[model samples]
Target chain A: MIHINEQQVSLSGEHSIAELAEKFKPDSDIFIVNGYPADRLTTVSDGDRCVFIKKGETPAPEEFQAMLTARHTPGIQEKIRKARVAVLGLGGLGSAVAAALAKIGIGKMLLSDYDVVEPSNLNRQQYFTDQIGMLKTRALRENLLRMNPFLTLELIEEELTENSLPSFFHDVDVLVECFDSSQMKAATLRSVLTRMTKVSYIGSSGMAGYASNNSIVTKMLQPGIYMVGDDISEARPGQGLMAPRVGIAAHHQANQVLRLIVGEEERRRDEHTA
Target chain B: MNILLNGQEKECTDGSTVLELLASLKLTPESVVVEHNHEILQPEAYTAAELAENDQVEIIRFVGGG
Candidate 1:
């Protein structure tokens, strides 16, 4: 048995990826075996994972979705697919969070950023130096789309004030606060948790400098409110926001979003069990 | 009045608003998120959100970073 684009199939004899692609998908030119680009001689054994895609062709949206969903937990595909996630501020945490969620095949995303990519942002943000001066909303969307063409995105490029925040995300299910400013971060969280009654809020703090990653943990401050960070470190002279720590916080927010979305599925299943 | 603040048994001035509680703890207004009885208070709502005995108040203070 071998996995092709996350679907399992039985093979009669040993076959290299090139042989398998030639046999199964003659038109497909890009072959990925176990997450790496399969060399001309890479062989598929039992339980090996392979993905074959055409160089310039986009698969049907449903096929793309199936390829993504086949690897998740049995019941998570539907729940996570329906979740609407909004990422505020495309900085270190926000950019990384958006990328992580998109990489995991999140169905819909509302990304808001009022700034443009800058050379300084290259230190920890998801943007590249080539993207410098491009609007963050536009650059991030382009990057995310390259990875998953089926992702639905709503990009807002304006600065989000408290008055403008609530109106932008009426139907959002999970709002992740990735603002670099403390005031803006708290403002977004407070606005969403108070005005947007139905949205779950996940906010981050203290992803600056080299600290024990162990201190960074997610806390459920209330039923629907969450905070992920060490909660103490502020950016200073020597201790600046680095990629490693910011990436951790970003993924923490992303994982918490997945947990919150998947937890809803668990809750519904539990309700039926009683 | 006595209330459960961050899961700890804490005492505050009688009839203290959420803002006053935060002030008592020396927390700046812009740095923390305040939730009263499971409902998060908006920035302006804090000063008017008076706490009662046995009320649950959760305040999460955050620092600047990405």
Candidate 2:
């Protein structure tokens, strides 16, 4: 069995991609096998996904939306498309998280950060070197828009205090804490997990230094609070925040947000009680 | 006395206040977030919230980094 353009097909014997294209899409000008552009002669086996596209035929917005949903499990993409995720602190972690959700077609993003793109931040942040000194909110919006033109971003350029945090995030379904300061990170978590009980709070603690990537993880602390990191490796003198470790932790948060958007939180609780 | 702290069972002296526990753990009040019996306590409340037997508390250490 194989999936072609998200439709399942049963094969009776071994076949090359060209053969499948002839049978399924005779006018196919290009082939995408396993999510990568492929040569026609490439042999397709069981469970492989192949998409045939004609050259210069860019999918329309609705067709583009269909293709994105085709890659994900059924019933999940719509939830992702409708989700309103808030990212606090458009630094390395927050920028990457928002970028990932944008790529996956998240409907709306509420992003806040007061810092500017500094030359120092280029080491880990997604901002371009040319964007140095620009507000993080502006830089992130420009980048995310380039990825998904359909994305709706609500950008706020201010340092969020405990009192100000909830006001901007009350309507969000998930709030990601990406503050680089320990004090503000704690303050934001306190604000959400206590007052914003309905919102899932995804927070990162300690992705610092050149630690083992395997050490970082996403764990649900309780029902609503999920943490992603080693929770101990604080940035200090010798150990600095680098791209690899920060990206790993940030991806964990992004993956968790997608799961929560698809109702994995509720599914987990049901399985736990069962 | 027995208490549940951060999902782990531990023993602390009965009546140990939250501030005392943070001090014993070498975690400054400014560096951590504390939840006592599932209620997030304000920094000022830490001094008054005392630990009791079987009480549930969680302390998450926060550090500077993305």
Candidate 3:
């Protein structure tokens, strides 16, 4: 017998596995009293408490995955199976972001990019010579499928216009902004905040010019946006844009997405407790 | 001489023009934006664009955004 989310749930110490499974089969994600992920009927020792958190209550999928795999947890696979994300760029940062999300089991991705590949892009963008003439969105779609055959990708190869931004973000759990221009970044951010309902995370200023380690910073912006790059302030004409920095930013964006999914209960709990 | 291209330092051998560098990178002529020393380099001129020591070259990929 233990307390779950303040509710008392009594379990006989000798209860069989089937009985325990029935008790835990409510379709909710479960966590242990120790903040570990757990499933129903998980072996319990004396004084171990359990909490059941309802699924679909979180916005981030990666956090849910971590919790699913966390010791003493039921597993976050169901939540991962339901996630849908939109990636709004296919350049260096966008390529890394879309690839990471697809590989991590995101059920679907809405990939949007208008450019074509160029040889110079090989220095930072995740594309090969054979894809040079292909549209960026189409190239990313093919590449992502190779990485995750089960992934469902919708490729949109036009520039993001005022008319398209709202509809593009509809039904998406999260938006990954990977634009390179400050003007476009500003426009996208404005649209996401004002016109879109789903939360968004943006990446700006990856290796843009010649700066050292001090140039790269990964941080949250407001409630949903994250910026990854070297100091936009220190950018020379060609010193801060490259693959390493862009990849780093994309990783951070992916982590934040994960954090949103699995850590919802904990985050809300902490918020309430604080 | 060395110039920074998209954050990497590349050696600039004598007579290495922007077009030569673009050709070396195998970049398609119409697909990217090149900024040399703060000025946008047009596609046709990329062939003859000469880079100086310490110049910063930013080859940017355009992406869809609202």
Compare the candidates by DockQ and give the number of the best one. 1
Which residue pairs collide, candidate 1? none
The numbered model that scores best in TM-score is 2
- For model 3, residues A1-274, the per-residue Cα lDDT tens digits are 6444433466556543234434764555544544666655566644554445666454234443433334324445556557677788788778888887776677678888888998878888878899999998888888887766667788887888644788767667777777766546545554554466355545464455434656566655445555566534322443545676567666766666666655542111112110
What is the C-alpha local distance difference test score of candidate 2?
0.85
> lDDT score, residue A234, model 2?
91
Instruction: Estimate the overall C-alpha local distance difference test score of candidate 3.
Output: 0.63
- Which of 1 and 2 is the better model by TM-score? 2
Q: Each candidate's chain B TM-score?
A: 0.93, 0.92, 0.81
Q: Which candidate model has the greater TM-score, 2 or 3? A: 2
Q: Tell me what fraction of the real C-alpha contacts between chains A and B each candidate also makes.
A: 0.80, 0.80, 0.01
Quick one: ranking by DockQ, best first? 1, 2, 3
Worst 10 residues of 2 chain A by lDDT: A265-274
Task: Kindly give the stretch of ten consecutive residues in candidate 3 chain A with the minimal lDDT sum.
Answer: A265-274
Across A1-274, the per-residue lDDT of candidate 1 in tens digits comes to: 9877656688766788888878777888887776567775887788777888897888777657666665674478788788899999999999999999997788799999989999999999988889999999999999999888889999998888876898998678788999888888878877765567677788888879989989888877556668899988787778899999999988989998998898841211111110
Cα deviation of B62 in candidate 2 (Å)?
Answer: 1.9
What's the number of clashes in each of the models?
0, 0, 25
Docking class of 2: medium
* Local distance difference test scores for all models: 0.83, 0.85, 0.63
> Candidates sorted by TM-score, descending order?
2, 1, 3
Native-interface RMSD of candidate 2:
3.7
- iRMS, all models: 4.1, 3.7, 12.0
Candidate 1 regions with alpha-carbon error over 4 angstroms? A1-24, A29-51, A54-63, A73-75, A264-274, B1-3, B11-18, B36-39, B45-56
